[model samples]
Target: MFDKIKNIFKSDKEENNVTHKNAPKEVTVPAHKIGPKSQDDTTTYVIIGASIAGVTAVKTLRELDKGAKIIVISKDENIYSRCMLHHLISGHRTIEGINFVDGDFMEKQNATWIKKATVKEIDPNNKKIKYEKDGKEEELAYDKLLITSGANAFVPPVKNLREAKNVYPLRNIEDAIGIKEQAKYAKNIVIMGAGLVGMDALAGLVEIDGIGNLSLIASEDRILDKQLDVKAAKAYEDKFGQKGVKIYKNRMASEVLIDEDGKVKGINLGNDEIIDCDLLVVSTGVRSNIGLVEGSGIETEKGIKINEKGETNKPDIYAAGDVTGTGIWPLATKQAEVAATNMAGGEAVIEDRFEFKNTMNFLGIPTVSVGFITPPDDTYDILTYTDGDNYKMAVIKDDVLIGFIAQGDISYVGPYTQLVKEKIKVDNLAERVFELGYSDFFKIKEDGQFEW
Candidate 1:
């Protein structure tokens, strides 16, 4: 891990000048205490999404200056960790264990929280939000509104799907809880899609007792294709098979077999393959929610179009996290902090580009990938290794390192991502790189340091 960060700093061979590393310093947010700092400003910042970005945003704003009013509104309490849902599904950790936060945590930060409101609409020009809770319609006005309303689960369209019983999507707290309740009645579990959540769900399933058979199906040829190269993905899929997890690739679930009254009996694949399963869990994909921005005057594309600073088209209004449709959570979360800071009268920014990669446990495969992007054509130099059970690979492009993948006995994900995010070129040659190692220079920073 230390070596990887060293590579990032040493690989500063880019054409443009990037900021040098800054020393660790204290960060003070304004939302902690209301004050008359810049303008006639008794601004109320309403932020949605409470998982990561929302919590980070509220805390960030409070720490920036603590002079602003922050109201955090979400459909649920700040307890669920979406990242850990797969583990919950696998039975490695219970839903109660992963969800640690609640209303009290926010109160300690001097912020007001609306725990059970579902945002219905946004009157962008009027600077107001419409929501519903307990059968009551409520409208809240804000001086500064931060829309961090996150993404939603992508439900797949399969025949007899609704008729099938015990169908679950591993996402929010409610979903995990539902799956847990249903897991007891079923022996076999079929998790659709071999993506991160599906793989993690399988990992979670292995830890649970009374789970007779677990089948993982991939519509694509490999798992985590969006985040890893073919070879790396293959290695992990092989690992899944070795773990006694059934692997079905290059096929889509076409029809869900249901009982007479309608409950999942089994699922039929595209190739006329029928697999029996007592329960079905889907982790197909995720789509950003743009309803809050619709007709709200915020620039709407595939995602909410925010300026480089995460500001929506309207003044004093910013949107971040999944709703911004930025496609990157870290960037979205960082943008939330930046937007919150700037909203509270501080210096903050958002960049136009960022690296897209994720490295979590892929079916218990010690794997990580960053910028492991295979360009349109075979144009870059690729270096890979697989000595016995160990595997490692580095990608260099245009005389600069562009991406790399590390697995089993490899620990350089931090440096690899930082290097890709910065697009830094190494002073050492590719040979020297694998030899000298990244720890010689790169640095590892925490999530909210305002680097990159």
Candidate 2:
């Protein structure tokens, strides 16, 4: 089923073009005066989220159809990179530095932005949306609608957690700021979940001067279990051990302890252990924000269901970003482009080629895992090379390379990714895997042409 879904989005050019590439940089435009108006129709476009996906849709739509009115409504006060929220907490970036687009992006795109606005409902039948802002309800209509509402942090239900103060879930800039302020005097910080968010938070919190004790609790035995193999995960485990970030595996937070003032005091683990801390960060996981379309007759499963063209069950409505339950940044951007292209009367489709590209760096140790890390049993031959902290692994089935993982040393990640997409025969390359280089794979032909 997964292969069939991937094949549906596979384009001829995409199957050949494998190296990691970024979407077009956001175009900076001069600011222009704008004001609110009553309901009026002029081919307006409405996008629910203002993050990467929604913003990219606006940019792509503008390029295809120049004069269409665009309006972006988001509960967030400003547009910031979700991935860079850790940078903000660590003092590596400021609010301005984390802005995904320029200050005049809405003005330049001739788009209206409704900040801190909550979309209460999506009415596909009437082509309208009901939203509330500052205790007032408002209705807006659109010719086309893109649901990029994205995802929200999923905090598990623990006793006293709801009433505990100074507890945060790192999803937006506001969350990061709140954590930063609490970290100022926090001596001990206990974080739940050992996934990407928890580890990144560990890396960022360690940089703060006063944060002395850090404990990361997770239900899994190893970090990044979904992305890394056992040995590769151990390397991170060892590194975090050296950095004084305590890792408690196979444990979940069962209770939240608070002080007399209802402030967070500590956490009680399911393993009968109590971790005393001043601040708590819940980085368990995320759930799609699909509340707006729950009863609007739009099909959804874990997220709003969409095709390769980013079209939902309803006409003139589309969905993308984390709300689609797809992969991370690259896939989100591609989905946005495809959705916007079709919305603007252009033809485009999202290619699944780059969905395999996943990379994460913790305290300067990089891990790049592409394609399936764990393949079907007895179907593929796996080759592994581990020297000290550096590890490289590859998956080959039917004489073709399918997956690659380079943990410590990620220098040849791009070339490996390219090889996977090209699906070149690995009969000759398998024997010479240890001493691999560009020449070993892409050789010069008899006519002086390079076989890429």
Candidate 3:
């Protein structure tokens, strides 16, 4: 699937022998050189951020309207996937390897990319945005605007944590780079919040050599409390334990011990235990970057509020991805496509707002979780299948399969997700839920294609 999308992002520039490593930070394609603009193509689309959602929107807009003016302004100079930052930290992939798009993506789309620009203010009334790049401030006008500013990692309010040095969040490429550099010399490295990001930090650090003591702190009873149940989480936790990693569960950092140089020396836990540390990685959580639309009449609660069509309260304005607090990668891309389609005078709406589905492969163990991990009440029927190293659980309510989890072998879990998403009745198949596959729900059409 990713290979197909990557091919769509490729252009003739690849035939001309261009590489992302040598691609320029900025690319400006003349409007006249693109083609004769039509009446509908006169719209100017400006997108903020350069991550998955922003880039996906850019591609969608260009595909829908070839001659439309597309401008992508981003604070990051390099285009890389935040999800792959752990690979970068582990020295598994380079900066260019993490890029999701092709080297000539901007050039192929005929878009203008303003890299390393910090957007200071957005003026929805005037349809202009003020930004600074290389110490110079500039303003740009747009007919349609997209805010995919993404999110920032939340640093907990641990005592002295904010004021201490050698602390980082694994949300950006720079943060990963900093952690990688510091890991070479640090005597003790402690990561707070044993969520996916913190586990990613642990995964990356374990691959590197000369890393002294390593420990993980989780406020919950088990790691990945939200994504996995206790039994499922234990599978991964046991793997980490075998890697010589210390696990501290149901504990919070009460204070950050700082040396005279204002650097992190260790951490004081709520249980009155002190763990020595020279570096700390905070992976507690993430909050949307909704400050860009603060006074722009764009309604916001936990994040920038958008309708089903991804339209903001303001006219001609749309928001997607993490900026809307839809942190899931697939959902973000879907939202971007829907928003871009609407901006191109088309109609699209998000049908599936369900965000509980997630798949992860950590330490060679693949797991899939959809909907609820635990039943809200005893009214729901719970079924399980456990063998040696594999575990599977299904939560059924009435006749519908509401939740499901598969660990060790996720090969036949596709139908389970479909069952949960489509609210399919699985009364007859409840006993063999783990054995379900696409064949159970799909039939061959006249055209020799499978239809669901």
Candidate 4:
């Protein structure tokens, strides 16, 4: 094991030495060649969590420094698709279809893959972690560390919920596999939390070749209560309703009713409503995995607190992704690369990737939200136009644009959002401003119109 660890470093050192080796075999060799590669040879980047942010950051870091040693430690043996866990539950996608990258590809990067290993403790002083693999425990060291453990599904409060035999969480790949096998004959499928995951599951399940019936229980007044506002949520409700999605809102799951075998039979609501279901999928918001943070001396703000640079209060220990509570995917990955830069180079601050304004989803339902969605009173004016599935709404406060939501008709929202994000003034010509964009804002005073 020690030899292998030494080889990982040796190869890392040889990689740097190979470049200098091409200097010509005829060149005189100094007795003691003092070079950067000779001293402190290993440039290892140990990134915890091989999820979205971690994987993306590793790729970006390799692009930045191809020779760096990347070590990925994850509890799971294979990569799990988090974005499509709902798809797994709804039987839209299979486990094999989601995992694009595998073990063989990682081996090519000079990356060490540790599976089923739990990080027992993070020691910043030694720059190592006391981890347990298989049955034995060991300590691993690194020059730089990135914590991107992602998030976990919330455990709901319901009697017999924890004891239910058939009930399972659709948070991971295994959960999805279990649901697929166990939920085939489920007469009633009760899904809790009707948020994005819930809706995603609904889409996936409704398209399922099998599965009997689906029931959704949302705690809030509307589905996706956190993401969508009242009006927009209502639109989704109406659409899902047409598909036989029974929605029960403003009710909490107080207790889960089980049969004699402790198998899930029904869910009792706090409002004294009993709903029976064979399978239950709870998709509440995730809480950051902070067990590694509790005693690590790292800062915590709901999630692990790190600056835009992914640097923690403790030296050499940085965090990123969902655990960092940045809520910015692109930014978190960028932060990891920046941390790698500072670790490989010198002391530098990692800049925040982007403000928590909004982002561009690759494949989405044409929805765009920036700043505050719903404005207060008439002080914040709203101009909205809706034609069936297409909707665009903009809010203005104090002669300046404040918030906006655009769906379906978002092809023209690109330049408009750029202006808002840059805080450019748009109150001058608020009316008749739907023309491609305004030239006045760009300091284009040619008295001409937009360039199409």
lDDT against the true structure, each candidate: 0.69, 0.77, 0.81, 0.64
Rank order (by lDDT, best first): 3, 2, 1, 4
**RMSD after CA superposition, every candidate:** 7.6, 7.5, 5.6, 10.5
lDDT of 4 by residue, 1-452 (tens): 00011111222233211111001111111222222232234678888887656665565455445567778898877764465565566664566545535435467566787888877789887889877888898888988888888777777666788889777766678777777777788889888887666666666676667667788899988876654566767777776677777899987899989889889999898777889888888777678887876677888988888865568898878787778765444444456555654555533355434343432221235455666766657676777767887776766665566666666666655556555665556554256345435444555337764442
Worst 10 residues of 2 by lDDT: 1-10
What RMSD does model 3 have?
Answer: 5.6
The TM-score between candidate 3 and the true structure equals: 0.89
Better of 1 and 3 by TM-score: 3
Superposed model 1: Cα runs more than 4 Å off: 1-41, 65-67, 94-96, 100-103, 327-329, 362-364, 413-415, 425-433, 436-452
lDDT of 4: 0.64
Better of 3 and 4 by lDDT: 3
Judge candidate 2 against the unseen true structure and give its global Cα lDDT, from 0 to 1.
0.77
Per-residue lDDT over 54-90 for candidate 3, one digit per residue giving the tens place of the 0 to 100 score = 8878887887787788999999988776766888888
Query: Which segments of model 3 are wrong by more than 4 Å?
Result: 1-41, 428-430, 435-452
Cα displacement (Å) at residue 440, model 1: 8.3
